[model samples]
Every structure is written in structure tokens, then in C-alpha cells.
Target: MLRAPGVYRPRADTRLLVEAIREAALPRGAHVLDVGTGTGVLAVAAARSGAAEVTAVDVSRRAVLTAYLNTRMRRLPVRVERGDVQDPSETRQFDVILSNPPYVPSEQPRPPERGGARSWDAGSDGRAVLDPLCVRSARLLAPRGTLLIVHSALCGVERTLTRLRRSGLKASVVARRAERFGPVLRARAGLLEARGIIEPGQRHEQLVVIRGDRPEPLEGPEACGDGT
Candidate 1:
């Protein structure tokens, strides 16, 4: 397993996203981008699944380095970069984009600027990253591209679906797993309950994988452009 300070470790949510990626049936040599690739687990999985190219992005330098080292150890040709998915600079659209961003609701309006909390503490509504990610995913995907994102249901699953659908993409919940709250969620249980996001004494949250697919051009088949 990969190890790094301030980097998110592989967890149930990560596994759920990986399983969803496998079920997506991506075309051979499809270009894949993994946003918030904490340990590059999904990126490595995509490479092993026959992706022609895999690129991973994260806002944390430590996360980028950790992912880079992890992918290298597996001998996977994953390109790891320090960047935010909401403001990605890469012009090429990806055939598949995967993300497991921070979704735990926090009392603060913004995520921490530094510290281990950045790995899981999202804003007050838990949409700080998820919201922008939905907007950017539409632009980052190529025609007929697929986007798979995993987040806690407490963050508003319907909201994510609504946002993606509003962006002209077909979105749905593809997979879900109910898991007991870990350290992060446990710590915020009171606040979440107070905000009525969770039931009193509730100790479990459902993690869902939302899939958004861009429709192919109707004017005739289009060739897959090289993902720059």
C-alpha cells in the first residue's frame, strides 16, 4: 500500500470507485483521468485495465508524490500531476474521469488550506469540491466520455445528479455501499446530526458512485481524438 503524510489512504470508497470503473466497459486504449488520486490506486487499476494513458491529478503536493511513487512501484505509466480538478489546465478531454474527492460535511465554509484534514473535510454543505467537480467534469470529458465519482450520500446525491444532468450529461447512481462512519465522519457526527443531515446516533453513511456519460455526436460517428 502507498504511504504518505497528509495523503488519503485507500478505503471502502476507493474500492467502490474501482469496482465501478471496471464495470464501465471503457473502450480499448481509452484515455483515463483520476482526480484527487490520493494513492493512485484507481489510476493503476485503469492502466491495468488497458487504458492507453492514465493521468492523475491532486491539489496536494504530498498526495501527488505519493501517487507518483505508488504508480511507479507497480510499473504503471501513470502521469501524476499536482493540480485541482475544478481548474484543470489540460486541454484534452478524457474518455473516462474518476474521482473520490472530499465529501465529509464540515462546519467550516471551506476546506482546510493544509493538514491531514484536507483529505476528507469538505465545506459546510460538503459540496465545496463536489460542486465544482460536476461543472468541470462536463468540460473535461470527450464526447461519449464517462465520469465516475464516489461520495457520501450525506453530501446530497440528488444534488450531484441534478448538477450533472443540468450540464447536458446523463447521470445516475451506479453503485452504492453502506459503511459505518470512520474517524472523520465520527468526529462530525454531532454537527451533521445538528444540521439534520444525519439521524441522531446514526453511525453509518451510504457511499454512492455516480456515473455521468456525455452523449455522442448525432451528426455521424466521430473518431476518438488523442487525449492531449
Candidate 2:
């Protein structure tokens, strides 16, 4: 139950991510961070999954408030903070990081600074937020930490995997689901088709959850290697 007008509502993508989280086999008392948390759905789910410390961050103030309120109402110990994943200020690392960020491609070169559009509109190629998040994941995760991010396949799932891997994390697609176009995507169907981002008459998009894991540190000689 979100009271904020601009906060994104939990939909198919959210449900998919939650299901993946439940199947992640998170260790008890694991620390989790939810980026772009709207209404704290994923954060609450993390708590229910036995995460000892759950923190949620979002760029929108209203979204932060809504998430905090929802978590409180559910009696979940989730700390909701207002922050942007693209330019995060928090320095704490976590065992798991979760996100269902804006992935919709828009005509504008960049997302809106305010209003409802901020919740779903990504840049022209839909990599505005996704790219940055992938780059930062390695730094945000603790040893053997995992990152689970959900987005439309139209936004380039392969690109995400490549980026995360280049950042020194093992990445792969763990889950996927095809969903019919919603009001937002439906309205941009023609433009997306024109841009060759979608089929001429495509009415659905595949949502994928990419999982990236930071490898555990090597011990003994590997840890104290000479310059090689």
C-alpha cells in the first residue's frame, strides 16, 4: 500500500525478483540492500527471508517515506534511505544487493528529474541506471556477495552480464519471464519498433533477473602473490 503518487508500484518485475530472492538460498543473518526500493516490497521480503540487516535506498523522497512506512506497518526491520544508485553515498557493503530499477526506454535522452516518469523512464537506450549499477555492484558487495537485478530484456541483458564480468564479478541470467506490454511500453511500442529495439508488432517483452557474484578471496600463496 503505497501512498506516494510517484512511487512505482510492484508489478510483474517485482514479483519475479522476489521469487528469485526466495530461491537465492541466502544464509541466515545475511545483510541485504535493496536499491530503488519502492514501497519496500523487496526489503520486506529480504527480512522475511531471514536477513539480519536490510537497507533500502531510493532517489525519490516520497518513495523513501512510502517504503519506510510500509516496512514499519509490516513490522519488518528495513532501513529505508533516500539515495540514488547511480551516485550512491552509502559505503556499507552487503551480502546481497537487490534492485528492480527503471528500465523503460524513453524518447528523452535522460530520465525526468521529478514526477512519475522518474520511476520508470530510462535514457534513450535504457542503460542510464543499469550501467552504473553494474559498475558499482562489485564495490558494494562483500566477499562472495551476490547482486540480483531485474529489467526488461530489451534493455540488453547480455550487455549487463558483460559489464559485470568485466568488473571482476561472475555474472549470469538466473531467471526470465515474458510479460505483455503495459501502458507505458504500449504507448512507446511504435517508437521502440522504429528504433529496432522491438519487433514491428511485438506486444510483449522478456524480463530477466541477472545474478552476479563476487568471488571469495584466495588464501595462502595466492593471497600473498609477488608482482606477476
Candidate 3:
């Protein structure tokens, strides 16, 4: 896979997300959306997994171009767009949504305006992007759609599942892997320990893939809200 400078390179998290998508066993004609598609890895996986339509979105120009090139090179039917998934104007829903968004907690007040850090840096608690994504997930999904998102356990996996459930989706952890702290996270170990987000001497973080599923509407009387 060709990657532009600073774009997120496919790693364990990416591989896990791909695995989750394949296990989903979605119908062939399903529409799929890949948000924060750094290198289009997940988008390509969705296409190969049988999605009839695949849309990949990213906020970085280089990432958008990289994704387009990768998909185009593979001759996959993926639409690459330089846009934010959290945008309100994005009303088109999909049968499956894949996201490996920014989850690294940073002391910065906002995500980076440019450079590689933008791909993984999220404000303070790391929920800067995660929170919004969880809140907007169900809206972006079509009925019976599935949302596959990967993030470090340091970001609070339960918080993500809880937020998704509150959005009316059935959410759960689909995959997890413990990995030694990478350069980025390793550099923040002191701060993380100080903040109590991780135990002192912790040199590993568990990455988790959370699946949020939007269920189909109930039939008959169940469809009616409130017995009254």
C-alpha cells in the first residue's frame, strides 16, 4: 500500500478493523462508508468484502489523494472525498460505516491543523473526535447498518459503547489487541500516568474495535412508541 508522508500507515488497528468488516458478512449490495480513511485501507477492504458502493472520507488533502490513488489503482469502486464525517450536511446514510479515527489524547485544545499528528491527535481526553463520531454514527447509518470503529482502550472503550447505545444502537467490543506503546503514546506516558488514565509503569495499551449496530424497526405493536 502506497502512503503519503504523515498519513497513517496501516497497522494492527487497521488490520483488526478489516477483520471485523469481513466477519460482518454484509450483503453484496450494501453501501459502505469509511470515515477518517487515512490510506483507504478499510475502504478497499469494504469493496472487496462485497459492498456495492464505498465512500471514503478524510479531512487531509494528502490522505484523500492517497486513498483515491490506492482505490483507483485497485480499480475499486470507491469514492474518495476530502470532507469531515461529522459535517451536518452529510446526510447520505450507509449500510456499513468503518472508522479508525483520531483517538490519541493530547494536551492540545484542538486537533492539529496539519501534519501527521492530525491523523491521531485528539484533544485532552481523546474524545474530541470520538465523542462526536459516536453521537453521529447512528445518523450516518442506514437501518440494520453496522459501525466498526477502532481506538485505544486509553480512550475509554466503555464510554464509546455507552455513547453508541444512547444513540439507539446496540454496541459492543468486536476485537481487541494489546500492543506496546508506540512512539507517540510512549512520549505521553508520563502525562497519562499523571492523569490516571493509565497505571504507572504501564507500557502497553489495548486497542479495541467497537461495533455499533442499528437494528431494524420493530413490526406490529412494537413499532408504536409508548403503550398509551
Candidate 4:
């Protein structure tokens, strides 16, 4: 797959999310959406897994192009767009939503709007991207749909779950892996220690994949109806 230097490369986190996708066991012909699709890896995976429609969105021009070209070359039917996931092209809902957005904590005050860092540097608390995703993404799912997201546990897994649940989805950590600090985090270890995000000398952090499921609508006797 072609990728610009500024695009997020498919790595362990991406592969882990893919595993979770397969485990999701989406129904045939399910519509899927991949937010922050750097190379459209999840988008392609969804198409290969029998998604009826695939739509991918990213804020970077290079990322948008990288995803578009990758899916195009594979002859997959994917609609790659450039924008926020909140403002997708249409009002359609998806049966499955996937994301591996910027979650690495950084000293940067705000998330970057461009460059490769945009794929990982999420901000001082690492919730700049996560916060919005947790708060707004549940509405994009169809009834009984699922949303899968992966990020470093340092960013606050509980907070993600709380936000998703508050948005009406049942959320929980579905997968986790302990990984040594990568180059970025290693470089920021001092900052992490100073902020008490990690213990002084901690060298590893947990990566987690969280799944949020939207319940089917109430029906029959349990459903609220107009007072008779």
C-alpha cells in the first residue's frame, strides 16, 4: 500500500485492532466506517470481511490520499474522505466503526493538524482526539452496531469507557497488551513521570482495544409509547 511519510503506518496497534475486527463477527453486508484511516488498512480489512459499504475519514490530506490510493489499487469499493469523523459525508449510520486514532501523550498543547505526528501526538493529556471520539462517535452506529478502538492505556481506558457509556453504548476493554515504551514515549518518559501518568522508571504501558456496542431499540411491552 502506498503511504506518504506523514501518514500513520500499520503497526502492532493496527494489527491488534484487525484481530478485534475479525472477532466482532459482523453480519454479512454490514456497512463499516474507519475513522483516522491512515492507509485505509481497516477499511480494506472491512471490505475483505464482507462489509457492504466502507467509508474512511482522516484529517490529513496525505492520509486521505494514502488511504484512497491503497483501496483503489486493491479494487475495493471504499469511499475515502477528508474531514472529521463527526461530519461524515451523509447521515447514514454504520454497522461497524473502527478507529486507531492519535492517542500518544505529548507535550504539545493541541493536536497537530498535519504531519506524521498527527497520527500519534494527541496532546498534553493524550485525550484531545480520544475525548471527542468517545463523546461523539456512538451516534454514528446503527442499532446493535459495534465500535472498536485501540490506544495506549496511558491515555485513560476508563475515561474512554465512561464517555462511550454516557453516549448510550455499552463499553469495555476487549483486549490488552503490555508493550515497552516506543521511541516517542521513551523520549517523553520524563514528562510522563513528572505528570504522574506513569511511575518513575516505568518502561512499559498497556495497549488496549475497547469495544462499544449500541443496544437494539426497546420493543413491545418494554418500550415507551404515547400515553393512552
Candidate 5:
């Protein structure tokens, strides 16, 4: 059953995350972190993919409980926790971190049908969760590790990339899908911009999967030039 705020239900996007992580070709036995482990979909996938250890976290206690149950059902090796993405105690460090954060920007009052906390909302621009996730990722990811984020293109992909770069991480677009919001799409960016969240002239509807890799000095320009 799908949950409120568009998170509870399992969707194709979750499967996409699993496929993308597998495509990255991470070594077996590597420690993995599944941020916002929602229904433990990615966590279970990682465990099945041969991760040595998988730690899953969600800010919602209910989600955490759900993840734990799901992990038990699959009999996967996963440690589930309840905490915010920015919490330092979430874990020491990880070899791989994956997250499908709440991607909708909060441009206006949430609908009566919507319960704010059940969904990922970052003020007027939807970066509330993502911005902090990026910062924490910089600290949590091990050297040469990878962090994958799936988000809607309507939220400002370029700006997301820029933030990742400023956070001492290299960001790039990994995947995208074109979706229509019809007449509602026209006012999306404006609603956010009116609140000074988005700058003028930003277009919506372009979900993307972004990848950020931990830096390795040996792989730097000097090493590349050394050619040895």
C-alpha cells in the first residue's frame, strides 16, 4: 500500500535506484548506507547485492519501524535507525550512500490532503532535505565512496549540482525522465521564485538521478599526468 506524501508505496523509481547502484559496480562486502530507507527497498537490494553491511536510516520513526519489519521479512543484514540526515551520530562512515529524498519544493501551502511531515518538503525550494543530505554525505562517505541522489528535475538540477560542488563533492547527472504536470507546471517555479527560493526563469519537469563521488587524491590531475 502506498503511504501519504508519495513515499509509502513502492514504485519504479525505487527499482531504478537499485539498478543504478548495481550498475555502479561497487565491490561486494562494501559497507553501504541507505539514507531515507523508506520501505527498505534500496537497503534490501544492497544487502542482496552482497554489501558487507547495510545501515538504513529515516527521520520518521514510523518509517524506521517499517524498514525494520521489511528487512526482517527478507532476512537481510541491515541495521535500521531513526534520525535526521544531518545527524552526526547516524554512522561513522560508509563506502556507499544512497538516498531518494523528498523532492517536491514547497512553493505553497500543502494541500489539506497532504500531511507535511509525511513528505519531503524543503521550505519553498525542496532543498531542505537535499541540502543537508549533501553536506552530511560529504562527511559520511568514505574515501573513494559514492553518493547517489534521485530527485525531480523540476526542483532545479543545475542548482543542485552547484551545491554539491560547493560542498567539496563532484556532482553529475546520471539519469532523467520527462514528465508532465500540465497547467500546474507553469506556476511551479514561479511559486517557488515568489518566495525567493528559486531565481527567475527556472523551468520544471525533469527528474534526474545525480551521482557524487568521494574525491581520491591519487586520481587527481597530478596522478593522471604522471601516467604511472
Candidate 6:
């Protein structure tokens, strides 16, 4: 139940993440990592779907607290931490990794509700946080692991793929919502325009879920009796 403009809502992208993870068919009791788990929705989903362990992390203290309470209320075995993805000391890898990161491009005014830009804005080009996130993900994921991210299509899916490749990961788009949403990719567009990178009215796109895999192929999880 992440309220306001940028925080992730459980019913929104969590369903996409859960369905994808369930389809992966990992062995029972496998470890799953949920990054930027605002309300622990995806973390809880991973637990419900039979993940042996679910570790969630968020940069915001409030978000961490909320997720902690939610997980406690549900009695789910999830470890919630208040930390930034950029920290080098962050360890604890996993078989599966899912993230609904702050993909909104920077330069956009912070929403009045104040979930705080830390939960959203990706910096002047929107790639600030995304780049580091992907880089760290490459090192953090276990061999033959999978990483899923839901972001704006306007952020240059092709560029994201290129970055993933550079990070030694193969990227793919699992789902996309075709509609107008400036809050998603406006920063990339703005930055490009400022640099004469692209012209205005370039037909921005909508939201999309991106899945990147390491060089080692992921072994689909074994089906649990009640994954449906």
C-alpha cells in the first residue's frame, strides 16, 4: 500500500513480478531479493509463492518501517533493511532479484505529497540511479540468476539493453503498458533536448517491465503445489 505519486503500489507492478517469478519455476525454498520494496508487497509475494527467503531493501527509513510492519502483520519471513542500493557493503545475494526502481527522470518537480525524491527521481537524466543499479546487480546476482525491473519505455529500452549487455547481462522486455505517463521518462527526454540529443515532441512512450539474465542460464523453479 505505497501511497502518493512515486511509491510502488502492491497491485500495480507486484502482480507482474510475481507472475514472472512463479513462471521461473525455481526450486522450493529458494532465495529471492526484492529491491526498493516500498511496502514489502513483492517481498510478501515472493514469500507466499514459496521463496525460502525474501530480503527486501529500501533507501527511505519510512518505507523500511512500513514494509517491516506489513511483513510482520502478515507473519512473513522477510528481512527488511534501510539502505541505499549504491552502498558497496551491501551483500547477501539471491537466486532471483526483482526491482521496481525509481525510474522517473530527474528535473521533474518532486511531488507535493513528499514520499521524497529518494523513493523516485532518478537524477537529471534518469540514468543516474539506473546505471549504478544495473552495475551493482551484475555483481550481486547469483550465477544463473534473474533480475526483473519495471520502468518507463521512454527511458530507452534499447539503451537499457545496451547497458545490461555491458554489465554482462542479457535483457528482455516482459510486459509494457502503452499509454502516456510523463512522470516516467520525462527526464531522459528533457536531458536529451538540453544537450541537443533529441528534439521535442519525440513521442514518448509508457511503462514496461524489463527482465535481464546473467550469462549463466537460470534454472526454472520447481512448481509448488499452490503457485497459482
TM-score-superior candidate, 4 or 6: 4
lDDT per residue, candidate 5, 1-228, as tens digits? 223343455544566677788787877998999988888888988898889999998766667878898888878899998876676565587988999887666654431224433445555567767776776787777887888888776567887787666666678988767654434345565675676644577554556788988786423322332211
Q: In model 4, where is the ten-residue run with the lowest total lDDT?
A: 219-228
- Report how far off residue 207 is in candidate 2 (Å): 0.5
Which stretches of candidate 5 lie above 4 Å from their native place? 1-7, 108-117, 180-204, 217-228
Off by over 4 Å in 4: 88-90, 218-228
Regarding TM-score, does 3 or 6 come out ahead? 3
Candidate 5 structure, TM-score to reference: 0.78
Q: State TM-scores per candidate.
A: 0.93, 0.93, 0.94, 0.92, 0.78, 0.77
lDDT string, candidate 6, 103-216, tens digits: 555665432234566666766555666777776776677777778887665456787766676677778887766554344445456565675544686644556678887756
Candidates sorted on lDDT, descending: 3, 2, 1, 4, 5, 6
lDDT of 6: 0.69
Clashes of 6: 5
| C-alpha lDDT values of all predictions | 0.87, 0.88, 0.88, 0.85, 0.71, 0.69
Give the alpha carbon lDDT tens digit for every residue of 1-228 in model 4. 788887888888998999888887877898898999999999998998889889999998998999999999999979999889755344778899999999988888898866788889999999998887865567677888889999999999898987787677788999998888888889999999999999999999998999988888722221242111
Who is ahead in lDDT, 1 or 3?
3
Instruction: Give the clashing pairs for model 3.
Output: none
Query: Which parts of model 6 have CA positions greater than 4 angstroms off?
Result: 1-15, 108-115, 180-204, 217-228
- Tens digits of per-residue lDDT for model 1, 83-176: 8876646677999999999988898999998888888888999999898788778778899899999999999999999888767678999999
Backbone clashes in model 4, listed as residue pairs: none
lDDT at 91, model 6: 74
* Model 6 weakest 10-residue run by lDDT: 219-228
**Which of 5 and 6 is ahead in lDDT?**
5
